[model samples]
Each structure stands twice: as structure tokens, then as C-alpha cells.
Target: MRSTFYTEDHEAYRASVAEFLRREVEPHHGEWEAAHGIPAEVWTSAAAAGLMGLAVPEEYGGGGEPDYRYRFVVAEEIARTNTTSFGVGLGLQDDIVIPYLLDLATDEQKQRWLPAMAAGELIGAIAMTEPGTGSDLQGIRTTAVRDGDDWVLSGAKTFISSGMHAGLVIVVARTDAEAGSRGFTLFVVEQSDAGFTRGRQLEKVGLDAQDTAELFFDGVRLTADRILGQEGMAMRYLMERLPRERLSIAAAAVAASEAAVRWTLEYVHSRTAFGQPIGDFQNTRFVLAELETECDIARAYVEKAALALNLGELTAVEASKAKWWTSELQVRATSRCLQLFGGFGYMLEYPIARAFRDARVQTIYGGTTEIMKEIIGREQAARYARR
Candidate 1:
């Protein structure tokens, strides 16, 4: 069944995204993967193609569109090309970082940052996870001490996506020792800040073109203007924005799974065994049938969730459900699809090999499957208790 989730405008945007990828990303993505970083030019090219900053207002030099389906179209197109490294990098910008600034930055701050970010001249990242911290924001050890006219920050962040290229980073730090949850604050740290330095880019098994690195702040100083939102409101801000972030992941998962099935379907129809095409085999037919059904179901759920997010009705519980379920589905879909390709799937030349590797991290990042389950479980228990 055809999904009515996207409008003609969204489909039109999807066509432009596909053309942009074919012209700019497809030819050079493998080179980027080998280099462990995408060139700065690609960012500018994407911005020129109007692929960046769909949610930023027009005053900031963006498309001024906030519809989540536009972003979903971009994800779907990128997944089709199997250039997920590029998708992951851009996801950090649009899904994670830009939303923070749009929601939290003061008007002056927006004027200062949004224009450049929308232009792809200033890449942004959020520094929340530490070497020891993953999923627990309260456990962040980065500290920011108040001075007469400055805040002295000292901390290290690990696994920061776009760390190598981000011109600005939102650093989460503990500002008070006794306030517990209210103790944390967010600081906008610039790359040019004195005493701020980037550690080596960390390597990973997937999304190799996207740079993840360790960041170090040794008494980096910031003025009051650098604060994002109110002091001690960082936790609240993070919680509020998570629905969009997780839903972004969920949408991408659905797209990637669908693409994997498409690729596997193409491969099975052409590759033959036992004097017939593999797709003609009963086992292959059954596997593709199962994958397609699941992909369809996941797509429906994600489309509904996207609508909920647009309407501000998506709860953290629902977002967590979408995030965990579709991510796990992506892993399953890619793995099973890869199996259908036989030995070719294991080769780097095949897109399935890359998809398999890239799918592994979907269930890990944006909060783990375990954490998502816990959130849902706790919500369920709370409802039962209320009853």
C-alpha cells in the first residue's frame, strides 16, 4: 500500500535530495570513509542545494520549513544511496544541534549562530556523553565555575559526533554541587576558545565518514552570553528535545531498512543458484516477504510518530518505543538482507556490507535499546500504579 504520509512538496524535496546526492555525495563518499572525514566543501554544497537547516526561520537563511517529513525525505534518500555516513553527519546538524539553538538560543545568539549554521559555514555539536557517561546526563563530570566576568570550564567529552568539524559545541557541565538534577547547565563553547582542544578522532566500525572525537576543555572561559537557555535548565531542555531526536533516529531506521530490502530484492532477482534465480527459491521469497512486511509496519508507525512530533503530542515514552523498535528492526532487516546476498554481502564492494555495519550503531546511540525499554517499562508501571 502506498503511504499518504508525505505531501507532494515532500516528494518534490526528496527528488532534489536524490539528485544532490548523486551529483555530490555518491562519487566521493568512499574516499571520505577512507579518510575518516568528509571535506568541508560537501557541507557547503549541501547547503547550496538547500539540504541543510530545514527548520530554521527564513531570517536565518534557511528554507524556513519545520515539517518533519521534509527531513524524513532527506533521510530516506540518503538511505537509498547507502551513504549513511553523510546522513549521520547531517543528522547531527538538523536533528540534534540546530533544534537546540532554535529552542534555547536568545535572539542575539540566534543572529550570531543560526545564519552561519544554516549556511553550513558553522557546524554544531552537543557535548553530553563523557568517557564514563552514556545515557546518564546527571553523571556528567564537566564543571563550569563562575568568575567575575567569565565561567571557567574544565572537562572532557568522548564520542562527540562531528567533533572534528564543529565550529561550535553545546557543552553540558555541572554548575552547582548541591542542586542535584538542577546543578547542570549548558555552555556554548567555540572552537577558537582558549584552552579548548580536540583530541584525536576516534575510529569506529560504521559511519566511517562521520568524525567522532574526544574533546578536552582545560579552563575554557565563556561569557554569560554563551549560556544556552537558563542556568540549571540544561536537563529540562535535553528532556524536551529528545522526542525529536529519537524520532529522527526512528525515521532513519525505517528508511534504511526499506532500502536494505530493496537492495536485497534486486540482488536476489539477478543472482542465480541451482539453475534459477535465488529470489525464485521458497526460502528467499519468505525472507523478503517477512522483511517487506516489517518494513511496511515500521514505516506506518514512524509516519504516525512524525505527525505526533509535529503536533507536539509525542511523548518521550512513545519516542522511545519508536526509537528502540525500529532501530532493532533495522539491524534485523539489514542482517537478514545481507544473508540473502550470500558471499557478496560480506564484501566491501557491496552496499549490504556497509549497511550491516552501519545498522549496528542505530540500537546503541540516541540511547540504547536497554534504556528505551526501561523508559517504556517505567511508564507502564506508573500507569498501572495510577490505576
Candidate 2:
């Protein structure tokens, strides 16, 4: 599973991240899960440890090093600890939100938000998915009408990750009602905005520590400066960012699969059945072999995707292939690992159980497995047609 992609610096970074997760996150993750949100202190502590701002520029209290490998270290360590909630929340920030600001935000906008975001003071969330429009960007019903220098925003966003803690949110809204996909715009809604409200914290079957909530924009007025990039550019912005987002999911998926294999390996070796260790049995050995081989392959694929993303050469189709493959691999790995644990795996107290629970949503979010395949398939068909 060793790769030439990581240097000593990456390994050193991994050690630091592992230490932080062990000291700050491991003991308290259960508490956060029960509350359905990681605490503000955790965010601050993560920033202090240089975990939150890998993508942020150095001028803005960040590492300023824009390598995806550092982010991969964070994802892998979180997966090792089985902190999927923390993993997803951090992904929303580092993988998804920061890139928007990096690529699209103006200097003044960056000056206003990046420092706080780097320091974890201004928690950011993107309000995209509605109750009705899962990944259908064209179907978002949220509206923003230009009224003088302000845009009147009226809509509700459900399943918003980091919804409860977000001090700054990028709200996707329809700016031109008749423009279809071109109608959508991205607006930055601050926490203190009038009529902007966060609704009930959603209870999910997994990633319980990540706060997923309903957000309401009841005629919240936003200035022209609050607009990101340009009016009616949300869909394009989304398309541009899709590769990194999906790759982030892929990175986490591979890591989770590896973790599942690691956990099951130890369990099967130590726990005995019949006359010897369960791992000694042919069935367990075969399962372990398949799981390990699959994880190793996933690791290679994700690393390559990460490199491609760094080089700005990662295509949507490539990202989709990685995303769908690793997501399904994670589900399969967790399910198989949990099976090895027998009844103990079904109990919530076991980490394997949490892995099994958390793995279900991997193929569902970041665009479903079916959607990823469709994207890849469509591109392949178009290329073949041209040929």
C-alpha cells in the first residue's frame, strides 16, 4: 500500500494529525455524535493545530500550502479514528467551501472571510441541497430578487452540513426565475442576517457528530457584495468544483475502507472460534484477502486522483470513476468487516458498527453512486459517438 506520492513532510503531518485526533477528538467524538454537532471548541482546536486551514493562504492565518495530500492525511487519520462526522464537516469546509473562495471570491471578499475561516471563527456551509432537489442544481427553488443594492433572499435549505455552526453560508438561490440552470446564484449569508434562521438539527442514522440542519432565508436581504463571482453563475461554479468535491469523498471512502480492513484484521486475529483464531479459518482469510486487496487498490486510485487534482488535470469523469468505485468499496468493506464481528458488530458501542452505519451514506452523498456512473457513462458514450 506504500506510495511515492507522500514525502516525509506528509508523514510528519500525518503524525501530528493522528496525535490531535487521539488527544482531542477520540474521547469526545461520542459526545459530539449524541449532540449531533461537534463543539465550537473542537473547531478552534483543530485550527490551532493547523488542521482547518490547509487550503487557506498564509496571509490569512493558514498553512497557505495548497496541496491536496495534506488534506488526505487529515481524512485518513479521521477515518482511522472512525470520526466520519468530523471528516465530513472538515470536507465541507476544506474540500468544498474554501475552494469557492479561493477561485471565485474577490480580494475584498477574501479579506473579509478567509482569516476567520482559517481560524475556524467563521464556520462556513454551502446551502445547495433542498428537500426536493437532491443533486438537481436546476431544480433549486430558492429565490433571490434584486431590490435596489440588495437581493431579497427567500428559501429553505435542508440537509445543510455545518448548518448550525455556520457563521457564513454560501446560499444557492434562483436569481432569474425563467433562466433554468442559469437562474441560480450564490449568496453569502452571515449568521447575524435579519430573517435568516437555522431550523431543527436533523437526526441521521450515521455521522451523528456532524450537524445537518434545515436553514431558512425568509426574505433575508443581502448586499451586492455578498454575491459570489457573478449573478447566475452558481451552476457553473458548482461544475468547476465538482471534481475536487467528489475526489474528497473518494479520498475519505478509500481511507474508511482501509480502516475497516485494519479493524477487522485485528478482530479476527484476536477473537477465536472452533479451535483457533477466526483469522486462521479459510473463509475469514479469503474475506480478509479480498478486503485488503480492494483497499490497496482504492488507496492507489485515490492517491492518483489526488495528484491529478493537485496538477489541475483531474477530469469530471475521472473523479466520478474514483468517487463511485471507492464509495461502493467502503460500503462493501464495512459490511464485510461488520459481519466478521458477528453480533458484537451490530452493537453501537463497536467502532465497526459505526463504520457500517456511516458507510451507507458514502454512496448517497457527494452525488449518488448512480449519478457518478451516469456522468462517466455519458462522457464515454459521447466520445464513442464522435469516434
RMSD of each: 0.8, 1.1
**TM-score of decoy 1:** 0.99
Worst 10 residues of 1 by lDDT: 1-10
Q: Compute each candidate's TM-score over C-alphas.
A: 0.99, 0.98
What are the per-residue Cα lDDT tens digits for candidate 1 across 1-387?
777888898888888999999999999999999999999989988988989998999999988999888999999999999999999988999999999999999999999999999999999999999999999888999999999988999999999999988999999999998999999999999999998999999989899999999999999989999999999988999989988999999999999999999999999999889999999999999999998999998888889999988898999999999999999999999999999998899998999999999999999989999999999999999999998
- Candidate models: Cα lDDT each: 0.94, 0.91
Q: Pick the candidate with the highest lDDT.
A: 1
RMSD in Å for model 2? 1.1
Candidate 2 lDDT by residue in tens digits, 1-387: 356989999999999999999999999999988877888988888989989978798998888988999999998999999888888988998999988998999999999999999998889999999989997778888899989988999989998889988999999999998887788898999999999999998888889989889999999988999999989889999988989999999999999999889999999999998889999999999999998988888888889989999999999999999999999999999999999999999998999999999999989888999999899899989999998
